[model samples]
Target chain A: MTPKRKQKLFVILGLVSLAAIAVGLTLYALRSNINLFFSPVQIAAGEAPIERQIRAGGMVKEGTVARDPDSLDVAFTVTDYVDDLEVRYSGILPDLFREGQGVVVVGQLQPDGWLKADQVLARHDENYMPPEVAQALEEAGYSPADYQAKAAEVGERLGAEAVGESGN
Target chain B: MWSFIHKLGSPRWFYAISARLMPWFWVAAALLIAVGSVWGLAFAPADYQQGNSFRIIYVHVPAAFLAQSVFVGMAVAGLVFMVWKIKVADMAAAMMAPLGAAMTFIALFSGAVWGVPTWGTWWMWDARLTSMLILLFLYLGVIALRGAFASRDSGSRAASVLAMVGVINIPIIKYSVDWWYTLHQPASFSVTSRPTMPLEMWAPLLIMVLGFYCFFIAVTLMRTRSEILRRESNKRWVRDLAVEGR
Candidate 1:
């Protein structure tokens, strides 16, 4: 190749590397802010601001969901296994909202340490199987409860890793 | 090898070759998409949880895949144009920009529709979604930059630089769910691991993804041919072709 063309290629390479470095640094600096929601552990560790609107996400703990028969009020404890955060909502829950499911609640933290949620969103996992397959698995003793437990375990591990990385 | 590269860089050679290849791509795209849509929407069983709304994956996933792939393809084309001074590559990049933008829009729109039923919200400022949105803007920026400059050569250079620089967002988009606590789920398909989805569930999605890729190639080739004709109208071969058509 000619020196001119080689120099042009080098210039392009240099510019791209410079841009990559710039973006990498920017993303690193904004790492905490880039997280969509605080895990129960993060909130418990006081990483989340008090009385400020924020989102907390984790698995809905088994046997922790309570609903009011006469009102739209509901209360549940979201857990990452290491910690738990109680969330209270007064609106219609999503169709997928149930025990042992992952959920993200958006609201402000009260002085009493509970989340008064204005909105609750269900977060689905990557698993996608037909009803028949899921039923077959369930019949084979791999019950939905077991699946939920496994999901909770994964969430707990991910949560712990997130806290560890961001705590620095 | 140098001669082969020069031939490949020639607009006339690309026009001739793509003319022969376009029909095959069009047929593949049509047949694949048609069969995949029917299979995904009608044959595949409903999800145990999301139910019928999960069928949207046939459209959403393919579109999202194409959206990212098209950006990467455009950037590669830009790099070729910049390094080799290949007018064909620049023309192809120019042709690809609008289609890439369209694909990104389709992905975002279909995702929003899917999110409403599954996530209980249409939009969120999550890492994956946010990075995907930036990708759409980057596509628009490249197109706009190309058209803004008075000189076509300058415009092409600017667009190439912008496309190359914008490529950093692609990896971030791919790993956003893993890197951050995003509402978006992690990718189901990965080269390194077994897919979480069953074969019955993912087969149609795979077909749809292939169909989208064929469609992209067919459309880009078609548009690039027109671009070549428009830019090379004064050339003898083009004039002869026009005369022969008459």
Candidate 2:
């Protein structure tokens, strides 16, 4: 082979091998740790790793939030409308965090079967269907077409309500 | 294969070719960004929770994506320079560093701003935020290191090595929120991953992401051409073009 061809072969071989090693190492290291959050169903199915910090994400069950009368401690149940996990947090929550909103709590599960959350983040309010919720909804057979059509139907109902309210 | 590399290595050949490509990218960038920005800010329905503040995602997500992508692009160019002794690759890497750095800054700034009203904090040294900060530093380090060396060849080689080494950080930045406990949300836009948003909300964001990519390409082509003229001023072909004044 000519010198140029030899150099090209050498470089390509070297880079491909280097890239393969990098990919191999990265996949191995990240495979177990790649989950950003766990759902109530995953926890119920004994899939969530225990005692290690991970996020538990689900909707805050309606009327389940209980705040301490004197302190910042708050307790709530997170549910996918399928299974439920109880989360107790002692710190102030995000302003947008409220009852029935999608939430993620960062903490570890106590052996007693409750999540001791160091931080609780409400994903947003009632109307905000975050990607996690969207995924969950999809698993339940909801699609974008269904969501858009439902939104239009709601918008029309709201418009009619406003018109009647003004007429009265 | 050798002939293709040889042709691409020539500044005159690249300059002529990229001139043809750049205009199309510029036009596309302008049209897409304009349309995406308008659609996202006005036409898209307000979020049920955050309301209009969520519109920032149009600029923020695209900026953050580009910031990481440009760093990886710089690393590939550096690898090309190191392995093949490609002068054009080194030139492109040098031009890309500052732009990548600027994009990283924008992403961090926008993220921080978005946080104040949402997270109620200006900053947090969480995994995602910290990794992105390190990416910005890596970009600056490459730019500064390249300029620090007295010999151009040594500087180019040094920058290439740094760029290639920094390649490890790209995936870390991408997966940091997922792998570690952090307040920052996980990846939103993925080919295999479905966004929680309905089509109305995410469509403008997709357009914005495409526009930002075109913007990166158009600017990189313009800057690389400038670098070529500066580096190859002594070449006969460059001198002829200057003489023709065309």
Candidate 3:
């Protein structure tokens, strides 16, 4: 082989080995952070820092829904049966949020145990639920529809206009 | 350990080991992914809330997990190249760029599928999605930079620098919500909390995660081996190894 060819080969091999080591190390080091989206039950338990912005997800509790008369602020409860959390958000609530449906809120935990939501998200369709929330419900022996169907009347009142607008 | 380290530093040794290991990883990854996906998608109970759409998690979470992991992998390769001056590391880094980018694409695509049902919109400038998009760009940058240079050595070095810089940004990306009033939600899972998923649900997830890792290892090794063979084709050992078999 020519000397130039040997040198080129050497350089290529060196780069390949370096890339492998990088990947191996990265997988090992950030395993914890990468797994952060898996389980919602842990987030609600305050296993993650309360001060850190985090997601709380579950079905909106049947009768715990509340709203502020004057502001975009709305408050509701999310439950995984054994554990329940109150989530308060001041925003244009997503069209899908209502009694019994699945929801995920991102916010900080206030001292009073309420989740002060910076954002609220509702599940998109009749058949789809947020993966995390659905997982939580299945584990809790609850179903999203069981809670969702009961609140249909109220959900319709809140969601009707928004749903129509989105259809356009 | 020192001797072992020396052996590992040898490109031929690394290539041979990775080559032998690739088949096992491919088989294991294929089996596990098949089983886990079938169980999660077909056998798992429909979500009480979501019914069937929640099935998207079967693909979304695993892809996102792989996407994040690839960047870290690329960065570590950069570190080795920087310190040890290993050319193989650069090749590995370059190979990872395409695979990582593919994973990121899957994650974004699956996330959108999942999002359409949950978020009431297909896209959001939210933290998680945006960070993921940034990660995609980083992968593209690495790949592009590697090809930009006239010298392979210079190209690898430039790509390594980019990978290292991107690694530093991971934390900032993860914490973007806390640092700013971004629309993205905070994390849902944590190290401290008891996993909220039932054994039925989480069991498959664990399988899928392991399978994804195995798949990554297999593909990377395959790519790396091709790289090694291509680079070392002129060597006497590589030539003799091939000729002797003939």
Candidate 4:
């Protein structure tokens, strides 16, 4: 190769090597932080440091919820069925939050073992179902068939009224 | 003055100066990192609220700082390449990609780790977090665009444009937390604001930031030097350097 061409080729090759080294070093340096994610069970088993803010995911246990009358703070229980944690949230609960739903609470553990949450996240279900209440119910071992049937009945009544109006 | 800038822009001149300083950068990075890490990790008192887990901030904060600062550096490099037609500037911009990306990832990951203990969630779409995520994507896009073209020059030019465009977004991202309701807190440390942290806390953090910059320079120089060698491989000096050593 000509000198100019060779120089260009060398430069490109060198950059690739440099990038590789930087990436390798960074990963090596921060390996511990990278492995910090843990499940609720792992956290409860003392695998995670108690003082660290951790995420607890699973169903909000039914009938364990209480909202402070004066404050916006709401307290609820979360369970993986095998392990359970009480979580207190002092913010606006997402519209989807309810009993027996799959929710993730992000916050730190208080001295009393209750999860003091900064945020509460509610994930919806597939099949066009608003998983908010249902997920919570399902987590609490309740069937959604009753709610679904009630909704269908309401829809049918509305449809009948619309048809009568067209005929008139 | 313009000629001076042009002279400094020369790869040969940069190679000479950077080579002279590379060892010093390495020494500084190593020493500062060692001292800061030791002080911050081992000696720094546990946060009144967070206890010991807050120690991660020593690395996390520095990485976060470097992640943002390097992009600014890359953007400056992009501007030089566009205005002055400096190939070295383009090269610097290109070289910054992986480093910036890695630092961004480090910041994100460390933030997540810190979040889990303090906030209780592994991730959130908070303003600062979201902006940092976009920065990661921007870094990826620049690197990808640089390698996308059939011709290397075309690739570098494309990457330069992308870098400049992304630079415009940085200020928007930085100010978004203040403007918008965000779960992420506003910046704790700044050039003007009185630091919220005590001397013990802020002191180590400052040392870490300096160490990170030194580390950045050391790595960049090593990469740039290697780049020079590879690009100039067929040149007489490169051949002699290779042959003399081998």
Which structure among the candidates has the greatest lDDT?
Answer: 1
Residues B47-110, candidate 4, lDDT per residue (tens digit)? 5445576788888879988888899899788767765577777777888889999999999999
TM-score of candidate 2 to 2 decimals: 0.72
The DockQ-derived docking category for candidate 1 is high
Report the lDDT of model 4 for residue A125.
Answer: 24
Prediction 4 global C-alpha lDDT = 0.71
Write down the TM-score for model 3.
0.64
| lDDT (Cα, tens digit) per residue for candidate 3, span A33-99 | 5432212344444455666677665667889888889988788888655457778788887655778
Tens-place lDDT per residue, model 1, A1-168, is 779789888998899889999999999999999999988888877778988899998889989999999999999999888789999999999998998888899999988889999999999988888888889988988855344665567667867777787778
Task: Answer with 1 or 2, whichever has the higher lDDT.
Answer: 1
Q: Which candidate comes out best when scored by TM-score?
A: 1
Query: Which ten-residue region of model 1 chain B has the weakest summed lDDT?
Result: B188-197
Task: Please say which candidate is ahead in lDDT: 1 or 4.
Answer: 1
> B60-151 in candidate 3: lDDT tens per residue?
77887788788989988887776677777877888889989999999889877767665756676655677789899999999999899999
- lDDT by residue (tens digit), candidate 2, A70-167: 99999999876567899999988887787756667889988777899987765532133444555676689865224234324433553455556557
For every candidate, the chain B TM-score is 0.97, 0.97, 0.92, 0.94
Q: Give per-residue CA lDDT, model 4, range A50-88, as digits (tens).
A: 656776555677798899999998998876555568888
TM-score of each: 0.95, 0.72, 0.64, 0.61
